[model samples]
Target: MKIAIISPGPFSVPPVKGSSVEHDIDEVTKMIDPEHQVTIYTRTCATYPKSAVEENRQFIRFPYNGPKPYLRRIISHIRKRKPDVIMVENRPIYVLTLKRHFPKIPVFVNMHSHVYGSPGMISKDKMKKVVRRASGFFTNSEFLRRHFMKTCKIPAHKIHAVHLGVDVSPYQVAKIHYSIRKIRKEIGLKPEDRVLFYAGRLMRAKGVHVLLKAFKEVCEQDPLARLVIVGGTGYGSNRLNPYVRELKQLAKPLGDKVKFVNFVPSAQMPLYYQVGDIVATPSVWKEAFCRVNLEAMASGKPVITTPRGGIGEVVTHQGSGFLIPPKDWKAELPALWKLLWSAPSIRTEMGKNALMRAKQFSWYATAQGYLEVFETALKKRKAASPPTKQDLRKTG
Candidate 1:
């Protein structure tokens, strides 16, 4: 099967950092069978050449001048390659363009989360039109799938859910123990400090302020408790923004107990997991599926996340980690204390369980799942009514 995956415009293939969706695309493309040819169309960056091929996978870049120019470039490229199935990540608005030029091809939109609230993306009405017209829709979590279905009035059969995955090898318990102390020291963590790690965007919606508030309470109860924030302004931005400033101000009272490492490369994230006693992702909004939880679990560390969106699907409450309700620090405080300040044996057992659970999700499995969706959608598209010349000319 020939596949063309269109990633979001913010980053290129083999993302250095802050491109979780692209990373997902890269990982899945790598594990795909050699018999199947894969071409990933991503945004061009200074680091990447126009075209590069590795193994069965090929990467092609296009400039992100604007939606009009981007769509024009995409149409020109796809007309040449004419892939069997086209899979686009996020940005539901792209479906209109694909349908206009490649009416015969099956197009699947893999949504990480709904972007309705985000600035300058497609509107809800446009997204609904995309959902109705596309061959199929997929989301990283069931929560996202259900939400999309309900919001767009699409049938359940049109949407599928595949949990996000992590490369569990580097985060194995053996590897973590090998450099535990060294990584801890490198991150400015003392031997006695019990670190709570948070790795994602520093935006308030991600619950950074809430995490700081909860950490302040934890520190008041236990001075040895520490919080390590490991992210910049997410979505490929390198510079610190006002949100980062706000978080810094929030953590000021807590002083050096809160450590901000800015943006750590995705390749080096395992070290942060190893140094943390517990991973916290207290997102106020409903996340589709957070890769941070999977990475932490793979590294043999317990995670304390909110019970919103697809998080419930990823975490088993009190089994692998605690799932506290979002923004309810009253509930969050106790859970944090229990995991971080309580018995060492409890944390150890939970970490062991987390590692076991993490093994269930793998990039290979995710890739295979995506292939199944592509095949099913393609077959369905083939069986449906033939595309009329009128359909090909229709552009919205």
Candidate 2:
């Protein structure tokens, strides 16, 4: 089968630094059956060629000045390819555009976040049109699938929940080559320090400020407690913004107890994960699906995160990590941090459980899920359509 995947034009197909959607596309395409011809349509990057093939997936890049021209070029190429199925990544508007051009072809919209489907970005009427026209919808989690059903008035049958996966091999290899003591010493942390790590955009929505507030109380209680915040204001962007300034201000009283590591390359994230005793992703917003939770689990570190949106679907509270309510994070986080800090055995056990859980979610499984959805949508479309003249002739 020939599959044409339309990537959200903001980033390149194989992400240089960060872009979870792009990274996901790259991983899933690589894991997909080699027999199936998969083509990814993405924005041109200075580092990569205009056209390249890797792991049986072909990438076609186009210059992206704005959404209008970028999507127009993609649509023109997609028409030429005449793929069996078209998958639009995180763009509901693109689904409508594709359906207008190839009304009979099965077009599936993969919703990685609620941003595109929200009333703020696309109106209720247009969202409904997308639901009506598109073959099916693939959400990263059941929480997001239900969200679209509630907000866009999409039918339950039209949406499918497919969870994302993590590549645990790198984390596994990192464990063998790198020691916790060495990583801590390299990062200016003492062997005795109890580290609480946070990785993601250092924005208000990510709850970095909340983590800082909680860490302040933790520091007051436990002298050995340390906080390590990793990431920039945005993906591949380290420019300090007002929110980052606010976060720095919040961390001022803590002094050297807090360490802010600017955006690290995606390849080096495993080493940073090893630097912490416990990973904290205190997200206030309803994350569609927090990849941090899976990455931390893969690194064999316990997590303390909010059960917002699809995050609850990923992290099993008390089993792999603690799922503190966002509202009660101030009280709960410090207490949980202290509990995990004091008990090394408990932390080790939970880390083991986390690794086992992480192993279950692989890129191969994720790619298979996508393939199943594509096949289902195609079969449904074929069954609904009238028999072709060739088919009628064959029957006659």
By TM-score, who's the top model here? 2
Model 1 misplacement above 4 A:
116-120, 173-183, 235-240, 331-341, 384-396
TM-scores for candidates 1 onward, in order: 0.91, 0.96
Report model 2's TM-score to 2 decimal places.
0.96
lDDT of 2 at 155: 90
* True lDDT of residue 165, candidate 1: 78
List model 1 lDDT by residue over 129-154, tens digit each: 78778988888898888887777776
**Per-residue lDDT of model 2, residues 1-396, tens digit only:** 899999989888789878889989988888999899999999998989999988678899999998889989988998888999999999888877788789888998999999988888888888888989988899999999999899888899889898888989888778766465676776689877888999998888899988998888888889998999999988889988999999999999999999988998787888788888899999999999999999999999998999888898989999899998778888887778767767878899999999998988888888898899888878877898899999999999
In candidate 1, position 80 carries an lDDT of: 92
Indicate the worst ten consecutive residues by lDDT in candidate 2: 176-185
Q: How many residue pairs clash in each candidate?
A: 0, 0
